[model samples]
Target: MKILIAIDGSKASGLAVKSAIGLAKAMGKPPTLVLMHADVPLMRRVAAELGTEGTRRYHQENHDHAMKSARTALKRAKLAFSEKLVVDDAGPAIAKAAKGGKFDLVVMGSHGRTALASALLGSVAAKVLSQSTVPVLIVR
Candidate 1:
């Protein structure tokens, strides 16, 4: 089965990845895993301070950290999955990516954060549920 695993370097996202791997193994098909890291734009001050090259370097560092965290999490679960990174915020970008990619399942984490907290935290899983055509399996 094809699975789009949304991760944001959170503990919850790690759980979701583990859950997806377990599901894939249970089904006897190691899923075609597509990992995504949505790049949340930085603050204006931070951007200005970083300037062009510095900002680019900062973004690259963030991307590398996200990828490294994802790889470590997947590795701990012993799951093999391909990865992709997008230069957009988590919510809308994740939904768009999942739909455009035609994934069968959009596996993600359920943050216990409430509406206000979710808004502040930028809940990609919630947005994916709202907009994605594919079925979502949320691992809390």
Candidate 2:
């Protein structure tokens, strides 16, 4: 099985990674794991000020920061995996990657927002559920 875990540098995201690790242990044979981080683009003004190289560096830094915790956890578990970082909206980007990569499962963390709050603020997990072709497992 191929599993894609979304890492967003949040405590909730850590739970998602931990849950995936537990899945690996239960399955006996570790499945293929892919770590994905989707970072939103910087504001136009900031990007313009930074220029191309600086913009690239900014993205790289954000990606590195977001992946650090998840990467460390995976490494400590002695698991083999790969990572992908995209500069786009987290919800759609994750959905696209999960479907395009043909992953059997997409694991992610949720904020557990209420219906009214989620409706008002918008929810990444909800968007992925609506848009993704692949099945998703949400860990809170």
Candidate 3:
């Protein structure tokens, strides 16, 4: 199966990776995995608050940290697979990527967001569940 695993460098994301791995192992073939890491843009805003040089440093630091997180998640997953790191909204990007890739399934960790919080911010899992034509496996 072609599987897309969404990760955010959190413990929850690690669980999602583990679940995907288990599924792939159970299927008796290495599934096509798309490990996605999404990063929120925060540097320019920080710069506006701190000034030019401060902003530049902040941007650099954030970028490094984001990349580091992506790499760490990938390493922790310990799977050989294709990966995508997106520097925008995660939910939309994940849904778009899944659709574009023609994946059969999407596996992700649930953050256990309350109904109200989910409604207000829009959960990524919820967005994918609603938008994706393929099946989504939400691992809590």
Candidate 4:
């Protein structure tokens, strides 16, 4: 099975990573895991202020920090996986990756927002669920 795990450096996302590992193990076969981080695009003004090198450094640092916990979990589980960092909206980015990669499942964390709150703020998980073609396993 091929799995895509979307992480955002939150406690919930950490749990999602753990859940994906458990699911893969339960399947009784080594699955291909893709660990993905969707980075928010920097504002044009901020990028100009930071310059090319500074902007690159900033994005790299943020990606490293965001992937740290997920990487550690995968290492501890002895799971081999590829890492991807994309600068785009999280939901659409995840959906595009899942579809383009032909992954069987996409695992991600949910903030467990109330219906009203989610409707008001537009939840990433909800958006992903709506847009994804493959099955999405949401870990709260």
Candidate 5:
């Protein structure tokens, strides 16, 4: 099975990575894994202030920080995976990557928002569940 794991350097996402590792081990096959981080676009003013090289460095640092936990977990588990960084909204970016990669499943962490809060602030997991063509496993 091919799996796409969305990570944001959070405790919840660490759990999700662990779960995916377990799932892969239980499957008795080394499933293909992709660790993805979505980078939010910088404001025009901020971009201008930072310049091209500085902006690139900033985004690279963010990606490294976001993927740190996931990378460590995967390495500790002796799992081989690829990484992708997208500059877009999290939910849509995840969904698009899942679809484009033709992955069997997408695993991600949830913030466990209440219905009202989800409705008001929008949940990434909820959006991925609604928008992704592939199945999504949300680890809380």
Candidate 6:
């Protein structure tokens, strides 16, 4: 079995990681786990202001920051896993990775925005659930 978990450096995502651990244990084998962090693109003006190298650094920093806690937790659990940092919107990126990587499942944490807020700002979880070919497990 293969699982891809989205990490956004939040407590909710940490819960998702814990759920992933339990799920893997229940499967009776150590499944392949992949930690993915999606980098929201910077505004055009900001990117231009940062220049090429600076922009690269910005994304790299963001990736590191987002992956930090998730990585620590996985390591603490004695789980072997790989990680990826993709520069794209979270919803599309996760759905694409789940399909492209041939993962059996995609797990992510949701802030559980109110209906109005979700409608206005759009829900990443909803988008992923709609677009993903694989099943998605959302932890609140």
**lDDT (10s digit) by residue, model 3, range 1-140:** 78988877667777887787778768866788877766676666664888877755654565455445545655675656776766677777788888888998989888999999999988988988887777889988
Task: List ranges where model 1 is wrong by over 4 Å.
Answer: 43-52, 76-78, 119-122
Q: What is candidate 1's lDDT per residue for 44-65, written digit by digit as tens?
A: 8988998989988877777778
CA deviation > 4 Å runs, candidate 4: none
* Residue pairs whose backbone atoms clash in candidate 6: none
Q: Please give the distance, in angstroms, between residue 9's alpha carbon in candidate 1 and its true position after superposition.
A: 0.9
Q: Per-residue lDDT tens digits of candidate 2, residues 1-140?
A: 99999999999899999999999878967899999999899999999999999999999899899999999999999999999999999999999999999999999999999999999999999999999999999999
For candidate 5, write residues 25-79 as lDDT tens digits: 8887799999999999899999999999999999889999999988988899899
Better of 1 and 2 by TM-score: 2
Q: Candidate 3: how large is its RMSD?
A: 3.9
**What is the lDDT of every predicted structure here?**
0.81, 0.94, 0.76, 0.93, 0.93, 0.92
Q: Kindly report which residue pairs in candidate 5 clash with one another.
A: none
lDDT of 5 at 96: 96
Cα deviation in Å at residue 83, candidate 6? 0.9
Which number leads on lDDT?
2
Tens digit per residue, CA lDDT, model 6, 16-126: 999998887777789999999998999999999999999999998988898888888889888889999998999999999999999999989999899999999998889
- lDDT tens per residue, model 4, 18-122: 999898788878999999999888999999999999988888888899999999999999999999988889999999999999999999999899999999999
Cα lDDT, model 3, residue 91: 79
For each candidate in turn, the TM-score is 0.82, 0.96, 0.75, 0.95, 0.96, 0.95
User: In model 3, how large is the Cα lDDT of residue 98?
Assistant: 85
Candidates 1 and 3 compared by lDDT, better number: 1
Better of 3 and 6 by lDDT: 6
- Tell me how far candidate 1 lies from the true structure as C-alpha RMSD in angstroms: 2.4
